[model samples]
Target: METSKVIHAIYTDDDVLMAAVKKVKANKYHIGEIYTPFPVHGLDKAMGLAPTRLAITAFLYGCVGLIVATVMMNYIMIEDWPQDIGGKPSFSYIENMPAFVPIMFELTVFFSAHLMVITFYLRSRMWPFKDAENPDPRTTDDHFLMEIPVSGNEKELHDLLVETGAVEVNLVNNTH
Candidate 1:
């Protein structure tokens, strides 16, 4: 079985890459992937990708963290070790609840940060101990790369890529 081959075109400027992407999208050519050093405004719309739902996930995780912190602190300080030692009273739920606010806030932030990071990594198919899958290393620095799988005519695709402002184009075959 033969899988689709990927051809990457590297561009020096983001504007040029964006124009190329827009042209390809307008031409109804399928764009396999795009890579840039930083976020490109309007790239998602050009690529027809749906809006990210990461913020919603973070909010849900924060709620979970808050509940966990509240329950754990309430049970431990009020139910399990109910005793008044400092004369200020420790068994009162209101008194100890205020003290738990700091822990609750910390856990909320911790869960949101860690879980959001993990979510992003997994969504992007990235993880620890995994080799980076980059077509061109320069795309991580000062270049923008577009990987398009050629389907019909190679010459037309190459011509379209060149005319749209690609600095260099190269084909990489993965045959086993």
Candidate 2:
């Protein structure tokens, strides 16, 4: 566990942060976490993180929404109480599919958007009314913080971080 002697390297420029991340990985240090004010391009790749699968999950969610919309429309329009919608006799779903196209598209996008957000939140362990786990409030505004666990080479890590243009480097000792 990364429970003690973690170094919090703070950087002001994203480019410097990116360079520091690459150099740190090259040196084979395990990075615990990183917080940034905004999303940095290619930062995940620099940190050697695995690619996310959220896009695939969103596609599956969209398919479910389309299926739900199709079944709901068929039941409501054609089976339970058939109505002559738009002056056309509604006997089959395929016959009146043109009118339902808008509803189907809207539902598809709606489910994909809403469910994707929920999935991201759950995947990131962010739940309703959860207390913030941010280590530094300045990271939310204009600073970037890289957390590296100090495993018996504190002096070396401190020197490397200072060489990598860190504005401030603080060693945080956890009580647990």
Compare the candidates by TM-score and give the number of the best one: 2
Q: Which candidate number maximizes lDDT?
A: 2
Q: Could you estimate the TM-score for every candidate?
A: 0.89, 0.95
Worst 10 residues of 1 by lDDT: 167-176
- Write one digit per residue (lDDT tens) for candidate 2, span 18-111: 9999999999999989999999999999998999999999999999999999999999989998997568999899989999999999999999
For each candidate, the alpha-carbon lDDT, in order, equals 0.85, 0.94
Please report how far candidate 2 places residue 17 from its true position, in Å. Answer: 0.4
Model 1 residue runs over 4 Å out of place are 83-86, 174-176
